[model samples]
Target chain A: MCDLVVTENGSVVGTEKGRIYVKLHDEELTTFPSESLESITLMSNSTVTTYLIKQCLTKNIPILYITQNGKYLGGYRGVTTNKTSLQRAQCELFNTEFSLNFAKKIVTSKIKNQISLLYRHKSCDDVSTDIESMNNLKKRILFCDSIDAVRGYEGRAAAVYFKGLSRLSGEFAFDCRSRRPPLDPFNSMLCFGYSILYNLFYSLIETKGLNPFFGFCHADGDGHASLASDLMEEWRPLIVDSSVLSLIRKKMILKEQFTKAEDGGVYLNKDAIKTFRAYIQNKLFQKNHTVESVEEKKSYFDFISHQVSTLIRAILQKDFSLFE
Target chain B: MCDLVVTENGSVVGTEKGRIYVKLHDEELTTFPSESLESITLMSNSTVTTYLIKQCLTKNIPILYITQNGKYLGGYRGVTTNKTSLQRAQCELFNTEFSLNFAKKIVTSKIKNQISLLYRHKSCDDVSTDIESMNNLKKRILFCDSIDAVRGYEGRAAAVYFKGLSRLSGEFAFDCRSRRPPLDPFNSMLCFGYSILYNLFYSLIETKGLNPFFGFCHADGDGHASLASDLMEEWRPLIVDSSVLSLIRKKMILKEQFTKAEDGGVYLNKDAIKTFRAYIQNKLFQKNHTVESVEEKKSYFDFISHQVSTLIRAILQKDFSLFE
Candidate 1:
């Protein structure tokens, strides 16, 4: 695990006796050794003392500063190690057979997981018709000649997938995958879960020295961890969606646990968010069977690192099949 | 993942298409396909439709019921899967050399990981004196005469170890390792994290078809997953402690996130618990270095199942070293 620190709301991380410590709100304190740390995330209102900065620079740990809402402020790192050549290859390989194959595999994997989720909550009668259409969509995406076509099929399948989600009914209904402020409780959980998921995938991508902004399916965007997105697609239903269904249906999260904004945006009450996060974490790490080759029953938790490592390996070998 | 559903605060989980659907407050609905779900957790004050119960029983899915505070409230499982022979072997093996070796190896692994964590975060000067004692304790435990002796050293070393943790000053401090309504935030986090860890390990034990109450390090206890506890020891410091330190030091958790009980107990405030759980979940599944035979940079997560599988293999082969 990387020893990364992220401080917020006027907490300053500094060094004491060669170990990292934090002084918060001018009173509270905490310390840690920086040996295993790979980076530090400094949110708005967070401060990094000069000594801590120097040690991070010397040790080559990147310090990422972002806003309270998680906008990327900037990053601090020692410049001796760079990946300019690798980034060039990432762009070059985006439209190649490698990217095409990887994207197809991930999309197919995602659809299959989505179908499986539908089958879980739906009766034989509920999903019986949709399953054939989904299976057809999977094959259509698998045979698409271009990334754009794959994206098209994916969008269509998502429409079907999201509609089927409505069948969950009661407290856990998804009416199209709404975003931004998350217009519904289910959407709020999904959005919240995905945000944590993105950060996790981004961290792994950064550690592997890959360009998170360049991905096969997702084109380059302003400060986006696009590659992380590409890697995360196959896992969305498997990890986040499954957990959402389990948590809500299992009654771990309820309707009263959410608050609606004046704009009709649904947000988890202060209490539900914790329960959501904790439950999601448990769900992610809890062991289960996956298509991935593992020693025994494996938790979806390792898939982030595992898949990212596979991406790096595939890129280095010019073999996209290695991914996923 | 298990099909078990925990219902509390008024939620009902039912079946739709061989899938479990949860209805909350009679208005909200969430569904999960029962495929891959091994069981359902039924908590108190929850209702299950007759059709759903019949489906679960017909499908042979066990429904484990617990209290809101998480006490075992019995279970609704399918016809018994007898383990007469395995239970006999487990009981006979508990006090044998097999148990002794498995217990010793786990202690050694735990000590090694602890030393690594200390060296990682400890100021060289602070740990200089403490390191020698820890090293000697390691050796002493290695050569201890009996299981009780090994337990003794583990306890003595804990005294020195807990003292060293004080070096992590500021808000991230633990006076001692406390449980059962942990008295400090750190301890509370530990207790909560361990609870989830126990469930994860217990699930694996059940899957392995081993008796959870029979174990090597921990003797049989009333209603305890003794084998899970034994398996959990090597991992507690390796996984949980490291994450606790990282999360607290990273400032991902804050001081204001806790509440003071009128009786002077510490508990995670409404918000901190979510962040704490989510962070721990991420930490548990966050990829890290571990001593396991694998293809890539493996996380300690797989070790949960890996070690259990090893335990099963060792018992079958009568070879104890397989556990480590």
Candidate 2:
């Protein structure tokens, strides 16, 4: 009845018109496809005719014989090379189902953390430029509000201003005026944070047919961390920034935990590394002490990686809103 | 004299005050520990005291048993609780051996390439500046020679000026270009070139006990392609520049092979991809077709990866000339 049937024993059978018969001996049972309806007997030298097997083979049907105990015998069938096409079709169907399920899961997850970061340095003239850049990024994410507007005078000057502002914002995050040689806590956290995110992102990318190195936003270069960088961009504020701030505020990791080396470089110690790893794992798993059940808390990291992949799939299908 | 000696039949024969004896159904043989002996056997019913076994165990010596057919069986005396020390010692020994062999192979093979590169990139303006930069780079593999040298110069401008001068002076052979958006063929080639290098570098970093993401030359930040860029810096002249120049010179790929989309974005076509892949593989294998004899050539990609790892080992040992 079916185009092809794959049995639990990992055997494939194709059927057009054929019937299989079974017989039992003293302690053993055997099955065979035969044309004639004859009763099987013990101690009888029964033989299977080649004509019946040839008939099944020519008719594009395969009948595989199996004993009662699931011992496999051979089968007769026409040559089948269309299995690859059928397999590809099946794979696509599974992928679509997986994407839809992942999307639904993300939409319903309780892992939302929204934070706005603004760079307020002594040299910068306009603080609103930072706000404006954040607004533009938010708008791209489908958050449209009057506050999310970039109010600027000149196009060329604004472009240059924004470029400078972006570079300054990055520098501000890295500069530590309090410490000698400036231990960049923000960038350090980002390095570790992105590593974790990239690992998860790569797993999701592998699930999709796309190569991780062949990316959309990042230009390919020799040793370009294309996929890692691409995925980390959208998640910077939500994950890396939030994690660093929480760690510092909670006094889980202190400034003293960072050591200044002879080469004028500062790095986190083993204790700090252990603390950070535990903190990140907790954030990723969304484990909350206040929550009644673990299921009530959902990880934002997991949601983003899975949902972004689904969003990419939906975009390919011309469903842009899925990204929002 | 040994406390105990193994018999030929894989049985333990106890030596009584340095006098050992073998018992068989047909015959028996006795010998002193100082005397040369043939294959020996132990009777199954012979009553051998357990105190001897305990004495052997306390001494940390192995009990040996010999078969009638001249086979020997050995057993340790004491139990080993911890394997970490043994493993560490074994690893140290193995690494020493591997390093020595690798250094010999590389020195013999790569000295010519290194000399040629140095000669080709020789400049006149200030030999000390270039030498100083190269010396500094030798100290630390990841570096921005031109960026550190030229004041008030930005990204591609600094790279081009440095590379151009170096090429004119016969210090380098490849042309450097600014990476532009909407990807041109040169940029595309660079992109592909870097991706290949990145994958290979990551694989090597994984083999060595180092974090690929943590780098020296590249600044730490979110989505910074530090590890990939770090590995690529050393091999840029050898692999990427050479491949791109060869592709251009041979005319295996044309400018028309790159399609400029309606959106102004350019991408290489299928034919160009094939050509690029073939070129990359050829470079990776370092196959020489002109010479009649089959000479094995190490791929520049493989050489860079090995060079970095060897450098890391050398640093651990406080050996400075690993790069040299």
A-chain TM-score of every model: 0.81, 0.45
- Listed per prediction, chain B TM-scores read 0.81, 0.46
What ranges in model 1 sit over 4 Å off? A1-324, B1-8, B18-20, B26-33, B36-82, B123-125, B260-264, B285-293, B296-299
Per-candidate TM-scores read 0.45, 0.30
Residue A77 CA error for candidate 2 (Å)? 42
Model 1 DockQ vs. reference: 0.01
Model 1 residue B4 CA deviation in Å: 7.4
lDDT of 2 at B218: 44
Tens digit of per-residue lDDT, candidate 2, span A116-153: 33332314445555455544443433221211121121
User: Which ten residues in a row are the worst by lDDT in model 1 chain B?
Assistant: B73-82
Give the Cα lDDT of each candidate: 0.66, 0.41
